[model samples]
Target: MSAEHTASAPAGPLWRLALGRSLGRSRKFLWFLLINILPLYVASDLLVTSGALAKISGFLEPVMSLWGLPPEAAAVLLAGMLVNLYAATAVAAPLALSWQQVSVLGLILGIAHSLIMEAVVVRQLTRRYHALTLLRIVLGLGAGWLLALVLC
Candidate 1:
C-alpha cells in the first residue's frame, strides 16, 4: 500500500470512529438522566407536597439551629447530601431564606452533596472512602459555621 493512501484511510476512519463513540456515550448519559434524575425530581416534589419534609425539619430544628440555620434548612441539607443539588434546591426554594442562610447552605452543600452516589464513586477510586466521606461532612459543617459567623 502507498504511504499517503494508508495515512488518509486511517485518518478518515479514526474521525468516524470517534464520532460514533461519542454518540454512544451521549445516548448512555441520556438514559442515566432518565433513570436517576427524573425519579429524584419526582420524590423531592412529593416531599414538599405531603408536608413530610416539614415534619423532618421540625425534628432536626435544634441541631440546625446550632449552625445558625432555620429548621427548614435541615431539609435542604439532608436532600443535598442524600440525593443531589437539584433535590436540595427544590426543598430550599419555598423556604424564603435570608442571604446569610443561603450563603451558608451553599457553602456546606457545595462541600458535601450526593453522599451515597459519590461515596460509591469515591470507593471505586480509593480505599479510604469512609475517611474521605467523614472528612467531607466535617469540613462542610465547619465551613457553614464559619460562613454563618461572617455572613450572619
Candidate 2:
C-alpha cells in the first residue's frame, strides 16, 4: 500500500473529514450564488423591462466601444471584474450577444475577472498586487481589443 494509505490513522476518518469539508465548501458556493448572483439577475431583468438598460448602455457605450462591444457588455465586464464569472454570466445571459462578442468578452474576462476578491489573495501572495492586477486588466483588454479588431 502507498505511504499515505498506510498512515497511522485509518483512512475512513480522513476520508470523512475530506468529504465534510467538500460538502461545506459546496454549500457555501451555492449559498453565495443564491444570495449574490440571483439578485443581480433579477435586477438585470428589471432594468430590461423598465427600459433603464438603454440609459445604462448609452452611458457605458464609450468605454465598451473600445473593444467593439455594445454598451450592454459593460454590465458583463463590470460584473466579471467586481464580482466573478458566475455574476458575469448571469448578467450576460439575457443579452443577445453575437458569437464574436461573446468570444471577445470570454477572452477579456477570463484573464481579469474577480478583481476585488482576487486582489486580496494576490496581496497575500505578492507585494506588487496593484501592478499585477492592473497588468492583468490591461493585458486582457488589450488582447480582447486585438481580437475584436481582427474579428470585426
Q: lDDT values of the candidates?
A: 0.82, 0.88
Strongest candidate by lDDT: 2
TM-score of each: 0.66, 0.82
Residue-by-residue lDDT tens digits, candidate 1, 1-152: 66663344455676686787679999997887788667765675677668776677787777887678877678789889998887787667767678889889999999999998999999999999999999999999999998888877
How close to the true structure is residue 120 of candidate 1, measured as C-alpha lDDT?
95
RMSD of each: 6.4, 3.7
Candidate 2 worst ten-residue window by lDDT: 2-11
- Full-model lDDT, candidate 2: 0.88
TM-score of 1: 0.66
How would you encode candidate 2's per-residue C-alpha lDDT over 1-152 as one tens digit per residue?
66664344555777786787689999999998899888988888788668788686888888888888889888889999998999998888777788989999999999999998999999999999999999999999999999999887
